[model samples]
Target: MYRKEFFVFEQGRPVSALIRNYERKDFPELIRIQQECFPPPFPSELWWNREQLDNHVSLFSEGALCVEVNGEIAGSMTGLLIDFHLDSPDHTWEEVTSNGYITNHNPNGNTLYVVDISISPSFRKLGLGKWLMSAMYDLVIYKGLTRLLGGGRMPGYYKYAHKMTPEEYIASLLDGQLKDPVITFLLHCGRTPIRAVANYLEDKDSCNYGTLMEWKNPFHQ
Candidate 1:
C-alpha cells in the first residue's frame, strides 16, 4: 500500500505524521472526521458509511488514503478513476461518484477523480490537507493519468449568495476579491478552476453549487 511520513509542526514542535492507504480499522475514525468536518445542516446522513468505505478500499485501494498524526487518524481522501471529458464535464457529485459509493470506478479510466477529502477539525492548519492532495497527485503520475479532477465545495458562497450570482462569486474568488475555505485551498494545491456547477451537491453553505477544478499531469502525452 502507499505510505509516506512527514514532519508537521504544531505548537512550535514537530509531530510525526504518516500518509497511508486506508484499512478496515480506520473506518470509525474516518466516519468521525466526516462528522467533525461536515456537521449539522451539512447532512449527517451524508457522512461516510461502512459500505462506502468498504467499497472505496476494495474497489481502488490506491485512491483511499489516510493521514495519521502521532498515531492518530487526522484526515483522509478518497478517489476513483474515471474517463473524464473536458468537453462535457458538467456533472453532479452523485453522478460522478456513483452516489458516493464509487461502484462505477474504472481501472482503465484516464483521470483520477477525487471523491472526497475530509480533515478533522483538530488537525486544521497543520498542512495535512495539502499533504493528502500531494499524495493523490503522486498517484495520478504513478498511474499515468491525464489529470486529477473534482467538484470543489464553495462553502463561502452562502455568505454572498443573496448579493451575487454563483458565477460572479466564483469570479470574485478567482480575481482574489474573496477567499473560500475549500476552493482557495484547492487553488493553493495547484488546481485550476474549470467552471462552476449548480446542483452539484446538497451543501447549504455552497447553495448546492460546486466548482469544477483540475490539475493537469505535465508528464502525460
Candidate 2:
C-alpha cells in the first residue's frame, strides 16, 4: 500500500486530517496509534491485535476508518451493527464484540456499536476524536440504524477511583461539577450514558469501568 506524502503546516503544526474508511495497509499504523493512546500496565490484550483488527476490517470495512494527517495515520475508528433491546439486560464489551472480531455484527440490527475510536498521542487536542465520533453518527443515519451503543471509558475516573464508586463518579461527571474529558465530549455529541459497564477492559485509568453510551437517531422515527 503505497501512499503519496502531503503536508500542510499551520502555525508550525500539521493540520487536522480527513476521515476515511480503513485500509488494509493502515493496520500497522493503527496498532502504533493504539499503543500511544494507551500506556503501560494497561494490558496490550485489551486492544485489537493484527489478526483481530484485520478481521474487523474484513467483516465491516465501511465501519473501520482512519484519519490521515500529513500523510500519517493520526486516528482511527471502528464499528458494527447489533440488535439491542434497551429494556433487556446489560451487556459486556465481550458479548457484543465477540472479543473484537464483531462476529455478532447483525447487518439488520438497530444499533451501531462503536468498537474503538483512538487518536495518536501527538495529535491530541486536534479535534480529530470529535471528527471521528461525528462520522459514526453519519454512519448510523446513513445505514438507517435506530441508535448508537458502545462503551465510553471513564479516563478521568482513575484520580477519583479510590474515593468514589464507578456509578458515583459517572454521576458526578454528568450531573455534578465533574467533567470527564472523554465522557463529556461524547455526551456533547448527543450520546447519553445509559449505565456502568463493568470490566470493560483492564484500564486502570478508567477503573476498569465503562459507561454504556447511547445516541438515538432523531431522523429515525
Candidate 3:
C-alpha cells in the first residue's frame, strides 16, 4: 500500500492529509464522495457501487487511491492500466473502463487510464484534487507507464453549446476564450487536449461530450 502524508492550509490552519490505497472499509465514503461531487442530472445510477469498488482494489490496488483530511475521507481517484494506442485513442468511458468495473485492467499496459476523480463538496478548493492527480503521475513514473489519460468532462460547456459547436467550444477553451470546469482544471494539472469525443458520457452539462486529455511521463523512455 502506498502512503504519503502532507499538509494543506484550510482557513489558515494547517490540516494534515494522507493519500493511500483504497480499502474495503473506505467503500461507503467513496460512494458518498461520488454523490456529493456529482449530484442529480449527473446520473445517480452511475455512482460507484460496492461491486465495482471491490474490483478496483482487487484488480488494481495501486490505481485505487483515497485522500483523508483530519481523519475524514476528502477525495478519491480511480485508475486502470491499459495498452493505449495514440493513433486510435477514441473510446467511450464505458468501453475503456468496463463500465467502471475495471475488470479489463492490463497489468502490463503502458498507460494509466483514469476512471474517476471525486472530491467531497466540503473539500473543494483545498488542493486535494491536485494532490490526487500528482500522486497518479507519481504512480505512472513508478510503474514505468508511458502516460496518464482520461476523458475529462466539459461541465461548463452547456452554457456555450447554444452558440458554438463542441469543437469550437474546445478551441475556445484552448485559446482562453472560454473555460470548462473539468477541462480547464486538467489543463492546469499538466494535461493537454488530444481531441473532443462525442457520446463519451451521459452528461447533460457536457452535452454528452468529453475532452480526451493526456499527461506524458517525462521519465518514460
Candidate 4:
C-alpha cells in the first residue's frame, strides 16, 4: 500500500509536529482541508460557528490534533471516545471517528477507535503524520483509554474477491481497507488491527472500507 508524509511549521520555525487538541477556532481551516480530501466532507459552518463547536469540543479533546505549516493550516485529525458493544453491554467504546485524516471513534466500549487520518497534498511524506499519531498514542494511553480498536478496507473485499474462500470472505469483510496514510503511519508506530466489523462503509469503487486497529501504550500496560 502507498503512504503519504507530513510536516510542521510554527512561526516560521521548523519543528517536529505531533497530534494536539483541536481548538474551536480551527473549524474554518479544518473544513477547508476536509473539502480538498474527503468526497463528502463535513460542513465548515458546523465547526466554524461557536455554537456548534461548543457542543462537539469534548468529543475531540482526547485524540484530536492538527499540523501547522508556516502559520497555515496544512492538515488536521479528529477522534472521539464513543460507547460501543463488541460482545456485551455496558462496555464504553473509546475511539475517534469522522475526520478527514483519521476517524477515531469507539462505538460503545472503552475501545479506542481511529476513524481516519490524512495529510495535505502539498505536505506529504514529511514525517508530520507519524509524529502527530505518536503524540495521539501517548495521549490515549495517558488518559487510560486502552482497549483500542479500529477498521480499514482490505483488498479481498473488492469486486475481485469473489474467488476467496469462506474464511477469506470473513476476514475481508472485517478488514475493509487500509487506514489513511497518517493512520497507517500511526499503525507503524504501534497500533495493531484486532477484529473486523461485519458491515462496512464502502467507498466510491464499492469496495468495503475500514479495518479496525488497536494499540497498547506500554506505559499503561
Candidate 5:
C-alpha cells in the first residue's frame, strides 16, 4: 500500500490513507464490497469465470485499484480494454447466450474502458471516488490507449437516481443505464460523450442505455 498525506486547513486536520493496485486474490474482497454497495452485484465466483464473461467483453485484471483508510478496503474500481471500433452489440450474459448466436459489430477504434467503480458506504463523501478515477486515468494513459470509455446511471446513488430503486439502478448502471452523470464524471477528469445507443439487451425490464463517451488523455488529445 502506498500512503499519502494531506492537510485540510478548513477542517484543521491531517488525513492519510493507503492506496494500491488490486490483485486476483483481491477478487473475493472486491465481490464482498460490491455486495455491500450494489443491489445485485456480481458474485465472488464470477470474477474467476472467464468462460462466463462475454467474448466481446474483457474482465478486470489484478491491477485495478483499492483504497484503504487505516487498513480496510474503503473503495475499489475495475477497468477493461476493448476495441472501441467494434460495434458488437453489448448485451447482458443471459440475452446473448439465449440467442445461441453472437453478433459482431466491430467499429474500429482502440480504447480503454472503465467497467465498475465503488466505495464502501463508510467511505463515501471522502475523495476516494476521485482517487479511483485519477488512478484509473493514469493507468489507462500509461498503456498508451488513446481513449477511455465507460457509463453508469445518473444522480450518483442508484436508489434515488432513477425511477426504479436499487434494482433499477443496478440494472440501468451495470446493465447499461448510459446516463449523463457518467459522461459528466468522465469529463470532469477529461472525457467527452460521443454517441448514444439503445439498451444492448432487449430485456423488458432493462432500462434503455446507449451513450458511449470518450476521453482522450490530454496528452494524447
Candidate 6:
C-alpha cells in the first residue's frame, strides 16, 4: 500500500492516517469492509468485487479514494460523472448507477455523482468516513463539477418502516428528537437530504428507500 501521513482532527486531538487513490491491491480489504457494513439484497458484493471496482477505476480513476489505518483498508469512496442538466426528478438508484454496474459514467458530465461511500466496521467512530467524503470533495473541485449528488440509504427507516412515512422519520431525526446511526452521520457531514426515493435499492435495512442527497460546492458555484 502507498503510504503518506495524512492527519485530521477528532475531538480536539490530531489523528494520523493515509488517504490515497484506490488500487487493485486494496480489493481484499475493500470487499471485507463491504461485507461487514451492508446488509442483504443491497448489492454490497459489487462494492468491492474486482470486475465492478475495476470498471469504475478504469472509467474514472480519480473518482475513487481509500483510507488506510494501521496498514488496513479502513474506508473507501467511489463516484462517476453525471450531467445534471439532463437530470429528471426522482431518478431511481438503479437508473443512476446502471443497475449497480456504473456503466453510464459520462466523462464530460458536469455533476459528480457519488456511487458509494463505506467505512469498515472496525473503523467506525474514527472520522474516516468524513475524511473520505472530503477527499471526494477535493476531486469534485478538481473535476470542475458544479455539484455532488447521490442516493443515500436511510437505514433508520427500516426500524419504523410500518409506523411512519420516510419523510416523517427523516423529519424526526432532523428535528434532533430521534437518532439514526447512518443518516445522522451523513447529515453531520454536510450532505443535504432533498427527497425520499422509493425502491432506491434492494436494501432491506433501508426498506428499499433512500434519500436523494446533495452537496453544492460553492467553489464550483
TM-score, one value per model: 0.96, 0.86, 0.96, 0.63, 0.61, 0.86
lDDT of 6 at 149: 84
Each candidate's root-mean-square deviation in Å? 1.3, 3.6, 1.3, 7.4, 8.1, 3.0
CA-lDDT, candidates in order: 0.95, 0.81, 0.93, 0.51, 0.52, 0.79
Could you give candidate 2's per-residue lDDT for residues 191-217 as a string of tens digits? 898888788866778988899999888
Report the C-alpha lDDT of model 1 over 42-137, residue by residue, as the tens digit. 778889999999999999999999999999999999999999997898999999999999999999999999999988998997999999999999
Error of model 3, residue 30, in angstroms: 1.1
> What TM-score number comes out for model 3?
0.96
TM-score for predicted model 6 compared with the true structure: 0.86
What local lDDT score does residue 76 receive in model 6, on the 0 to 100 scale?
85
Displacement of residue 157 (Cα, Å) in model 6 is 1.4
Alpha-carbon shift of residue 143 in model 1 (angstroms)? 0.3
Q: Which portions of model 6 miss their true places by more than 4 Å?
A: 1-4, 8-15, 39-47, 85-87
lDDT tens readout by residue for model 4, 10-111? 456565443455677887776666666654464443332344333346544555567766566667654556554556321112223343222343334454
On residues 1-221, what C-alpha lDDT tens digit does candidate 3 reach at each position?
A: 78999998999999999999989999999999999887986778888999999999999999999999999999999999999998997899999999999999999998999999999989887999889999999999999999999999999989988989888998998999887788999988999988899999988889999999999999988
Candidate 4: count of backbone clashes, pairs at least 3 residues apart or interchain: 56
For residues 24-137, write the lDDT of model 5, one tens digit per residue: 555566656766775544444433232322322323343256877667777776555556554563544324222211223223335666555678876676767777777766
Clashing pairs in 2: none
Candidate 3: clashing pairs of residues:
none
